[model samples]
Target: MSTEKIKDARRMVHWPGHMETDYIYTLGIAGEKFFTEMKNSGRIFAAKCKRCGFIYLPPRIYCERCFEKLTEWINVGTKGEVFTYTVAYVDVDSSKLKEPTIYAYIKFDGAHGGLIHKLGEVKHEDVQIGMPVEAVFKPLAERKANINDIKYFKPV
Candidate 1:
């Protein structure tokens, strides 16, 4: 091979880009029920494993542990506490926002799985771990059968 050809062969290349695609997701059996209930009745249901009595929020059709099929559904309390939290000073695009947003892992009483949501009606500087909070759902007419149906969690 020619020296020039060898130099060209050894040349390195750099490419930076993002993958783009369009798609829609169906939230499956348990998800459909949960979202439908939220959108239509403003209620939350936890799926309880028939075999081991494990309850899952954003309920699952099957148990994570015993691999048992979960069939029974029970209502989960609207009130919960902040399991963990953080104040986001930047947006998803990594740009700084004018106002900080507080995000938290809110574990409702009696539910095994918890919801991750934004905290409102409190200062970003005031958010604390394990703070008592309650979900503030949006008015029924405005709900869309998604977690956003609850606008945010507020101090209880």
Candidate 2:
């Protein structure tokens, strides 16, 4: 009998609340030159609105303030302070994390707004607004054109 025929000969049962995702995708630009530069150089980069002086982290291709295409990239310092934070008991998949994860909005030195990232090396309860922190990046080989390339923020 064929493999399909063999499986058809057996009975199977489905369980309630047991399902699988039909599709999942890992989508992003294959070649993000700016992000690559930042990761390899260990410097944070942002897009600046030449018209309005508004800066955007994760470097936007266009300026939200002036509605103009951004042509210039600026380097932001690694040193930052926590603007706000929250402690999450759940992991990315919504399952309980081994330990609570501290997430924070980190305002880089001299930047207007902040970037969100995981906060590490400190207890979740101890994370607070105005806490000084800095970016910690992964090895070059492990980097992707994504925010997660900067692994997490650690105490400065």
lDDT of 1 by residue, 58-78 (tens): 799999999998989899868
Runs off by more than 4 Å, candidate 1: 1-18
RMSD of every candidate to native, in Å, equals: 5.4, 8.3
Residue-level lDDT tens digits of model 2 in 55-129: 877677787777998878778888899999999998778999888888899987655676899998888877789
Per-model lDDT: 0.88, 0.79
Report how far off residue 127 is in candidate 1 (Å): 1.9
Clashes of each: 0, 0
Top-TM-score structure, candidate number: 1
